[model samples]
Target: MNHRNPILFEVEKTLYPTVYTLWVYPDLLPAFSTWPPVLQKLAGGADLMLPGVAVPPSGLPGVERGALCAVTLLGNRAPVAVGVATMSTEEMLAAGMKGKGFAVLHTYLDHLWEYGDKSYPPTLAPLVPDPAGKESAGHEEEQEGKEPVTSSSPDPVKHVAISDLSLKETDSCAELMGKEELHESRAAEPAEDASPEEQQEAEDTRTPQEQMDALFNQCFFHALKCKVKKSELPLLTSTFLRSHMFSCCPAGQQLDIKKSSYKKFSKFLQCMQQQKILQVKELNKGVESIVEVDWKHPDIKAFAVPEGFSSASAAQDSKSEDREQVYHAPEIIPLYGVSTKMVPLFQESGHRKGSVLSSSEVRNIIINYVKANELVDETNKNFVKVNPILCDCLLDKSEQDEISHLKWDELLSRCLERLQPLHQVTFFGQEPVVRKGNIEPIDITLAQRSSNKKVTIIKNLELYGLDPQCVANILQQKVQASATISPTPGAKDRVQVQIQGNQIHHLAKMLLEEYQLPRKYIQGLEKAPKLGRKK
Candidate 1:
């Protein structure tokens, strides 16, 4: 085996190093360090852009185009992100350090990072030039004898950047400190005293953007650090903003995105994204969701409030709720009506007969029955041999039409016939899930991202008994594109796999030819539709 780097580390049959970060050997790969924002963006599955990169006074870190390199954050030597250079270091400088620099594959805090040793790279003084790289877009100032910093204000804790100031925060701070004097003033501000009315008036002078930013910051902090449950991650973007985010906002401040410079709701989210506070994913076409929040953000730690603050707010909320309700609504009760009854074709250890199950439940039980009894045909993975249980559950009443060997999809649909009655389980806000004994089809959508780039997202594969990790590994090798496996939006138990660019046609072929999956189970193929014959 040619171990010329890009090593394939496997566990059992699974290729655990499915991402580029894992492919590159840590010791052999050349490294560079930049600001946290750059590393954060890389970590969030973004390609590194030129402006975001920092260069030592000595010059760009030498690397060839397509060469794998390790990226570390300033103030820390740990290589938190790994990327393949899109342009050579010389070409990068020749191009005036513009356009794409590195295509990031994997980074710290990503799924692959968590899968590994979680080892921290030692302080990388190796890449450190005779001096050091310029830091944070000229935001940091180095002292004569002090260690170089990513940021270096006297009170680093309170010194928010001028650019970071919204209309509300900046205008208020300006008006309070004398509006005209703000730009003229140096880093050191002239201390001044103001009456209560003056302070309130100054606060009122903040722009709507400022107010929204403050509100959004507070809401985001609360939602991540307090309100959200550990179980509710990769939360749907809409639900978080609409439900949890608004509730966490300071009392009396309506969660309205229309009031700010970011008029569209997604625009407001983009602003938060620009700040590197959270990671958003376009899991489906026209649907953007907050996939991850940076709970370990310095801001979260710096702005930590007393625990009593939440308790006090909770008390006030309870009192307000008690006073606000004129009449209580009826409690939601699980109302079960006659629906569908199901039976397994095979009576395995846990597969019992004469039990009433919803369509989903029955589907689950039948799948278990098929697997437990080892009914699947060994020669071809897609076909399952009919046993007495499968025959009873799937066979037609007429013996002549009895099919002894059944495809997995056919077997599943046939089993649904024996499920005599189906029941509906109504959720709080969703359509009642009917035990229809219908197999939930897989969803493949072309999702659009920034720069009009498109990604092909295949979801709900878990329903077909496909292992998500295995599927991701196969796609990675087959397509030669970046593939990320994540939890499907709104469904935690199911997983979705994504590939860069439009892989619809390729995916369809892969599913049909490679995996032998039934075409009837896939949806959204029409969006990509087959192309006509070439002239």
Candidate 2:
């Protein structure tokens, strides 16, 4: 068959009814890189021209005939002029389209020819002489007087005098014709310099729905080039289908048929499963495993497993058992010493033994006797002790005579005079001091000395009218003498009493009560004696 007439012979067998319509925006030009090499080459070489035709501007000097131009057919209308450029042969060469333009043109023409009766405007029939008429002898008389037509100067070919196309038509032929007309009108408009903002507005006029259609066309074209069949096209474009099958399905649900990689789709399904929006089951199918799932019929309770297998329940039971096992035994207490064993003694009235004793006991037993016997000095009010038991047993006949007429102070002074000579007497490795009518217990050796005989006599001064001060003073003197005379050499042997001045006053008050002395004498005794009596 002649290559020029190839469409006439080949179109019936090869042509498909469905045609892909693609639109290119300025910003999306880069995405052309993603197109198959054939498409990229076709798009790069194609110029902006009238739809369904490849014609360059007549006025341009260097323009060549049959050079490629992209004539945009807008919604089956006449083609629109957008922008024009020279073809990209390098891109075409890379795509193996170097000498293959004829092949592509033939393919395109064949599609038009087969579908043309159904697609072309009724008005266009008048522009082309009937092929049957040309074959008849009537066509020879029409050319007999005509000058030979040159390719450059043939009478300007009459444009098909068809009515402009409209998008409102339901028929496919009418839609295609409408788009062709629309494209031509757009191309004929004057190219005034438009502001960027105006250009942007023009660009933005195409809606998202329009863009989706363009993308679908691009995809369809690619699939067609791969030789996909008419029935398979629906499945491939099912993502744009309005059916429940695509809408209700989970994000990553892989249909029975596979094409592109489904890794992203698988991840989407897993996410849906986690959210309880889908349910999946893994089925072992030979070496490969297949997952079967329902996305719309999600099980809400799938995540709520029973308590026995749950970690939370086990932790709670363990805590409860630990609390139950904690021991709370009673405390043990032990009894110790006199605090637990002794019951207290009580008086006949039920008051305790020592509790009932008062100041009356001391006044009656000691104070009244001293007062009645005039043992304490009345003029000086100086207190003295006169225990009758000690006086009768220890005072001897001669010493008694000397002290008998003296007042308690005078008697104490005389006792001190007599006892001074016995201060050197030693007993139990200690020397004992002596005062006239006062004595303290010493060892047997000191008790045997005649000079020390005065020791027991002074001890008996507790029986006479002797104050505890006089007794203490006399005792301290004796202890000092013993410390001096004894063979023990350490300073620890010295006797000292740490009494504060206020405590000495308190002692005087107590002595006043014991001896029946008046407060005046006790007051006079406040000052301690500065010097000891001369030896």
Candidate 3:
């Protein structure tokens, strides 16, 4: 344990014959030694507020929400308590250091400490006499210029009505849970025919807001102006409206949603959608949520920060400054000189027979065509009955006569065959691109499958721009075998063509002799001489 790192420590132990060291992390909330009474409260499992934390010369460590961090009381660097961060580092900084900080989980005096025979932290700094907790509370109240309301429980959390200066999201969460029940009860009561006292009582209960209508408008605009980000859409309806917008109502005025004319949350959302400000998209079959936002809306434009606030010249000059980290996408090597073939249904549909299409585009066309023609099986869509167009497109004449039913994936393989060989290009890396027209060394490997069945895999043939469907067809004819596409482990972007039988001998011959790829590019050919016979 040292200045920077205090809580983390390692211990060596032996079980039977073997000895090993293990690292242990305990719950200890870091605090300034300046505040011992606060540490005492924390030892009793009290949650920490931002105000109680003393900012040392070194700022708070970068901690994400839900990550466990040690709380080291000032002077002694050893952690006294452990807690989980309530908000992310960026959020805490953006919030100007106000509100709750860590939600304390465990401390030294807790039961967990009883199991360990550990020494207490060494105190080096002079211990100051503890100040009265009430006096500090009074000082805080005076600073905020608001009287503190006491709860019956000793818990630090205080619950106040909407009439309070600030209404937090945590406060409204419980109210929203019981909104429906309250609405139903209100309808059951004969409130309209009530006497003067009852009417006055009702009026008293409903805290009067002179700008109630205007407040809703203000909150709606405010939520959009600040809380809602352009990137967050399509937002979830329940999450966006009820959780976000409802909480944005000005402090001291609760958003009385029942008073609004809209009967339900969805009705209000529908009205927004109808106005074309944003579209509501149902995800996974009618699970409604805010799915889109109208970035170009006039109201949104008005609320948006004006462009060029930081002039282009200033931005250019400050390029070397330590700005926030941004993520840049990994560059992809572009492929050119590719073409695709048309399926039988679209053979004369004007798509060139040997033209090229991306793998995804080809898939979309096939699936959409199947759906539009209603060719999918009524019982199981995966099982497609042999049709003339499919027979011409997917299966060879030999296969057509022998097979009456085929799986959907097999058809996809045939579709992939129509694409012209793709030639890859390098943008900024040292990696060489095998000539777009030339075949690369065939990557061959042996692996065990379920039931201990061993299989041989061959890949890199596709990198030569050769149609995988054509290779599979040739393999089936020459070696009397079948193959399937297997996603390569550790390389998510690449897939290897897998053959059921160990066709290493044939696959190597096909690549070396038939494809005429340079011998230098070929790998594992020395092992290819062994007869890959079935066990």
To one decimal, what is the Cα RMSD in angstroms of model 2 from the true structure? 50.8
Q: Which tens-of-lDDT digit does each residue in 2-88 have in candidate 3? A: 111111211111000000001121112223221334554454445555545545434566778866556654434545555567787
User: What TM-score would every model get versus the actual structure?
Assistant: 0.28, 0.17, 0.21
lDDT of 2 by residue, 1-535 (tens): 0111111111212211111111101111111111111221222222221111211112111222334222222111111112222334343434332222211221112233333222221111111234353333223322321221112333312321112212221233433433343234234222223332443344334444433333333322222222222222112112211111222222223222223222233443344455443333332111111132231221211112121223322332343223212212111111111111111211222333222222233224334545655566555565454344324422555665444333544433333232212112111111222233222321111122344321211112211222222234333343342211111113221122222121333334334443343343232343433445321
Candidate 2 Cα outliers beyond 4 Å, as residue runs: 1-203, 223-535
In model 3, the worst 10-residue window by lDDT is 14-23
Question: Against the true structure, candidate 2 has what lDDT?
Answer: 0.26
The digit string of per-residue lDDT tens for model 1 on 81-166 reads 65668889999879766566765555555544443333333332212232223342112111211121114555432433223423
What lDDT does candidate 2 reach at residue 463?
A: 19
lDDT of 3 at 521: 63
Candidate 2 structure, TM-score to reference: 0.17
lDDT of 2 at 347: 20
Best by TM-score: 1
In candidate 3, clashing pairs total 27
Candidates 2 and 3, the one with greater lDDT = 3
By lDDT: ranked, best first: 1, 3, 2
